[model samples]
Target: MFKRILSALSGKKSRTSTPVSSVHADASPPSDESELITVYDSYGREMKITRNEWRDNVLLPNLQQKWSDADELYSLIISGLNDGFVADLIPAAAQLVAIDSNPERSHVIQGIVLLENGQLDAAETTLRAGMAKVGATGTLLTNLAKVFTERGEQALADETLWRAVQTEPNLENGMLWWAAIQRERAGEEGYLQALRTVAALPGSWRAQLWRARHYLEHNDVEPARALYAEVLAGGRFDGGALMMISGDLGNNGQIPLIIELIGPVYDEHKHDAMAGINLLRAYQELGNADEGQALLARLYALGFMPIKSQLDQFAQVFEQMRKQDVQGVPIDPESLKFTTLALNQPIWHYGLRNADWFFAQKPEGASQVGFFAFSKSTDGAEHAESQREDELGRLSRAIPLYLAEAVHYWSDHVGTCYIQIVEGGGPVLSGAEADGQALFDIVPPMMKYFVTGEIGCSGEDDQVQWQIALSLWDCATRTKSATESGSAVKADLGALVLDLETRLLAGVGLGREAPLDSFYLRPTAEVLPVYLTELGQSFMLTLLANGHVPKSSMWGERAMLDWPLNMALHWPTLEVAKLMYICGLGKALDYQSDVLAEYKERSLQMLRELEQARSPALRLAPLVWKVFGMQAELHAYIRELPADTSPEHKAWLDRVSES
Candidate 1:
């Protein structure tokens, strides 16, 4: 039944379209189509092979399908350049000459490739022809200036660069180029003079924004606010831009200015989460209790699942502030423990969409089995000072999620994880204080059975001992149904989980089987630990994308974004891992996340592979493709997909498009 549902839903076409512009250009493909690949060839040196070999081995196999896809093709070129496989990109860039849309960008890409391949004359002609047809976009002009500089025409380059900035004062590359030139010729004074000139340009909010930063730096609040208001008036700024402005004010000790400039207009729906954080900080620092509590309540209502920890922490601070004001009680904010909010909420990949539908379809005899986070049991001893302690905390949450996914995949039952939030901003590793009765009080009505456990580790670094005790609770009878416990070395964690999973499945009467049509597959021992970590990271990123948590909070954890793609690329045959990868990439792309910028090429390559294999991940591929500036391809791809029958799947696809 579930397979039939997926089949129906996966076939639905999207109800949107994106237009592609037409541009005509006359240019021939590269004359030397060498099959023999090497680093030196695109660097103006050669290792030769016949045209037939090149066509069969390289062009047809790699570059042919992506010819018209500017984003995919350029991603390939850039990735190849970064990895020293430039020779492979010559044909890719050659395809750019014939692209219809993004003519200016296409020309820039081709010119850069030409310049890199030592075709100075060809590069110059290409840039000039592009300018004639496309009317000189800042990016096009900037690259054309580079070609001039490469040809030792310093005067022409200088003239072209100046024109580039005047033509598009907001282009970072062009503005940076002009700034560097002025600074070299003069100094800091000249840079400021050039910035002022550009800031005066009509419709140049970026320049105005930069000037505002400068004013704030010099403690000139009025000028900064005026400039910021002008930028806001342009209405071209996005949430990210507002966040940047807020960051500048916050960093410059202009906290009140942040609220003054942004408070009136700030909407959680329209502004980045960081802007709210700034306002909250301002209210808290000023002891504005009513306003602080109001803002905190708004943020909490967002229900960002992954940032449960961070939001809980925020709640604790605000709660403390409220307590001190009303009760006149001295509460050390640090002494606050459990969150008063975001309690008992289960972490599911797809948010509450179709939740009723899910439980409604459960088999008559089957039961809802929830797996809550394992408590960190210290047994009253001084907690071991192991570096792996953090790892254990993450696993406590991750293990439950993994187990829940497994249960749902292998049986006709509801499986979900309850990783409650702690006051200090991390998963609530519930110990004795958050006991069974306490947990049972918070579960939803459909949950008839639940699992809980305690986990701890000893020793440090490479030598660690891990222990976990698990119990199954019958919500109907309000009794412990079964129990399982195990101890293992850090290297043997997978073996331990597998053993526990087997017993838990048996205890609940679930039979494990691999279904060919199901998206879920049992993760292997080799992949489980790494995949668990990825799951936790994926959850974090998904929350971040939803605007529930500040991006700054996850700065040190970028591996959460990169590792899924890396792991999927490494273990291509693992369908389970690929699911996580697609989910992670979709969240990152949907949110315009910068964390995945470094892995763009890898992600593109993975997408291509998934496309070819017709992987299940293709169901969610539209979300990933749209934000990579591949709107045309995104529209075309969506039109080809059939309507998905699964409400969960359809909701995700629709939500990304709507967002």
Candidate 2:
């Protein structure tokens, strides 16, 4: 019956008259006489009456008519209409006009209708007008802003939203929406503020989590960690939060803390790949390599690929140890033995400098002082023990320790070695003759090996000369082989040596050119032939061509021997080659010019390769014979060339011919 009435009111059904009007003649009169009405008898049969009969005979005559109020009339009319009926009855213009008086309510209804009808402009206009009249308060402004935003007017929408927030400060909805808008506009800070406001609202876990992330992004680790812990303590075990905190702690080098924090999380959720991976890294960084390896095995059992980068990093720490003899310093048996035997190595041997120096150069926050000593098999165990005790043992050892005294004397004054000897022996050894003899014995063998690859003990002065010769040899060899190696090797060596030289020279008050070449070069050269042969011509040539050889030599010599001038001369030829390649010709040159310029370039290149070859059979004759034409120009100032040759041409010819 209700369906029939609704269909009839909507004009989908034809109406029939009912006898109830005749039975109840005291009822209200019909508003429209021609309108159809359907009446059903209790027996389910329809009864009909003529319009005139219904209006005059039964409806109109019995009705008590009164003047109609417009508001009441409008209400009655609107009540009778469905959404579709109202839309069909009222024109858009009439609706817009009706909105002026009760804009909020009118626009709300109209906006919905317009939006439904795909009339975005009409909807926006209606919503904005309604909002303007209502002072941007309550749901009206929020709805208006939403419509504007939906239509892609974000700025306008945001403006309206802020107004809405201000209009109803106590309303959480407006504030939350406004906060969201701010977040979208402004990035992390905006989001953080917005999320904070959101979190103040009851039961906003998602908001709180985002706020924590904002703290983490800014490196406020303590707060981030605290927040995450708070969340977890509150029984919020989010996987993402756990992962983030773990990674943060690991990156900050808080390896042990990271493991402790994430251990439970990992155990509870063994299936989590990220947790497993991070756990592995944390263990490795904390020096719990065994534990880290075990975790990796566990991850493998759980069907995960082993993280290669973390594995490599762990391997590197150990590999670096193997390359250097002791835990910290380079591999030197004497230094190691002395360090081991000394109860307090820093005080006894003077090798460990002041705490200030160590602290300044310390790795990150490393605080502990430790040492490792090595005893060579050739240095008889008893002799090694005696030397260690003499140099590093407590002051009560009774035996005079010369090396310990020398180290102590050298540590105090930069150039005290020479001065002390001149002053008739300082603290280490007494008497000029004894001091000179000790210096000669201690320094000469190293010097002789460097100069000529032979240990010559002719005399004290002879040792000094031998040492100088070795220094020259090292510089020559370093320069000669500079063009053969790759740039990375050369650069690494250079940086290393430069740092060493700076330290050594600074310690001794000696210039870089001081003739300590024999001390450094002889040992270096002895190992160089084997080193170069091991690194074949190809590697050597690549290193030299890239100007790495000189850099390596400089670093090695400076750090090991403190030989400045010798280190400076190591890669002159290679540097010259590089200069020529960079300045004289580029790829733009013609093939003929490039070939002509290739001689000096090729010669330097071949020299590098030759250093690498094990035998002459491995050498390329073409590379050996190739001469660099431009390099000969280096000799131009030494001798005059033909009168026909221009200065530039002569310079170029001289550089090539000189080499």
Candidate 3:
């Protein structure tokens, strides 16, 4: 398994596919045009207005009737395909031989799609036919050249693209694409032509962005900055140009420059939740939870509660420090007890953005019987109708790929083990229904026969069967609450823990023939510690569970290798009280007050701290609060027992909090 898989896909509009021309056609105006037509207005952002409004504004009444010029008709249709009256968009893409909508460009898209799909002969056939019709139209020839290059005919691909630019002097995407290829083949001359292409299209944002991307990719910072400034000045904020650039900078670990570039934009557009999240990411990488918290506070003040998974992690970093360094709690990593022997971090878990694993260590060294999941995502944004289909398609393909990787890494495992699922196919800020079924689809036999009803949704409420624990949180970006109505999984970890205990006691997670709490299951018999981290922050759950953890569990391979390994990395400096509350709840999850348990005194200390907790870092579905209530009930349960029968009852009551 691997942490993150950033495939080096073509990230450009024209680069990804050969070239595309969307389909649209002129139509007679309807009598009662109530619903408006939506089209891409300026910068790929949709703009909507009624057809009559378009006529009233641009054509002025009879222009729709008078628009009979074939050249104008084709131009309007093609432009509308790019802007409004848009017909369709594809996921991955459909290879085109010849679509009737726009045969010239459609043929190009078809040929490129064929080439990409490894149908070299089919693609060549499609491209040749298109060239015959369009006569060196940039789309056809450039793609033909690509096929040529793929077939070891590099000179032909280059010559064909050159012919494209020579014939269609002002073909924008073609020139950009041609220039890109030329830089390698034509060297300085190609670069000069790219510059000329940019100049030719004065006031074109796409052209500038393409050029800016070239500069940024090559580390030509100054020119990139100038182009970025002009794009920003053009008021394309809503168009997502800056956010796209921010993604590039953030991914490359350029935090400081991102802060500088987007600070003014963020200030001006405080209402943009996506922009705020981008800045929050920068601050998180900087390990400035105080500023990060401040940013969250502003969003709260604006009445927008962005999903705070990142914030929750940011707060956890500071919390762990306070308990160990400031409170003199003498926190020891050795306190954790694992049911299994060891854990192994495979290659797949390396660079994940948000990933978590639940493990059961075998008696053997460096082996874990657990599921580690890290998601691989493809943005399904701006294509609402097609997203659900595309999301499933990508996931279906990814599942087997991960299984293959697991087979290679986890060769020693006996049966089917481990599951990874993708989350949030698009930006969480987009307010789409975030998918969670994949998490539940672990293994039906495991869920139905054993851990049924352990998480929340039972067999009917959720059809998934695997012993995996999953709760889907639907985050509402524009609202005050981070969660709208969520699925049936327990919102708190304690409840989840109790459920897991019941399942293990019933021999749920153990493989089919294994008895109750087998080595395979490694049930957290009494206490189990839980951890959560995203970007810069991490949460530690100090709950009671069952297991015989090796001494090396404190630090080993496949261990907490990031922040917990280097606490000094991006040291958090915000609220510490909230983390104490999490610690309290974590302790409560691990609470062992059943007459003979030794951690009752520590549990009481966690409860006392919970009362004074007043931080907003975890207001979004605060699980710690639930832990407090459960701890109280736990204390009451032990108290109700007769002191005469309880083991060492007197010493337990008078016990002091462990330093």
Using Cα atoms with residue i matched to residue i, what is each candidate's TM-score against the true structure?
0.49, 0.24, 0.30
Candidate 1 lDDT over 1-659, as tens digits, reads: 00001111122111111111111111333455443333211111223455545445544444555667666565545434433344566677778777647677667767777776778889878888888988977777787788788789999999998888888887766776787789899998898888888888776777777778888889898888898998887787756568878889999998887788777777776677767777888787777766876676566444332233454456567666755554222334355454422212223344222233222244555567888777787766443121212587788777877777767766556676766553334344455424677767887777878898888899877578888899898888888888899988878888888888888888776565763235555667767878778767766665566655556444333346546656766677776566556566656655566545434444565666788988866555566665455677766865676775566655655655655
Ranking by TM-score: 1, 3, 2
The superposed Cα distance between candidate 3 and the true structure at residue 514, in angstroms, equals 22
- Cα-based lDDT for every prediction: 0.63, 0.35, 0.38
lDDT of 2 by residue, 1-659 (tens): 11122222112211221100000012233455465444332112244544444334422222112013223223322322321233332343243345335555556555644554557788778766766777555556666666677689988888777666555543445565676667688975785677676556554444555555566667776776676666666654444556656776666666675776676556523234566677776765666654664454444333211232343354444333333432322233344311012222212112111112111121233221111111111222222111111111211111112111222222221111111111111111111112222223333222211111111112233132111001111221222111111111321322332333233334223133422211122113222322222112212122223333333221111011111111223433322122212222211121122122312322343344435543231122221232323323334333554566455544433333432
Against the true structure, candidate 3 reaches a TM-score of: 0.30
lDDT score, residue 174, model 1?
76
RMSD of 3: 25.8
Please give the range of 10 consecutive residues that has the lowest summed lDDT in model 1. Answer: 1-10
Clashing pairs in 1: 8-645, 9-643, 9-644, 9-645, 10-644, 11-642, 11-643, 12-642, 12-643
**lDDT of the structure predicted as candidate 1:** 0.63
Q: Candidate 3 residues 55-92, lDDT tens each?
A: 34532222232244323333333333333322221211
Of the two candidates 2 and 3, the one with more favorable lDDT, higher being better, is: 3
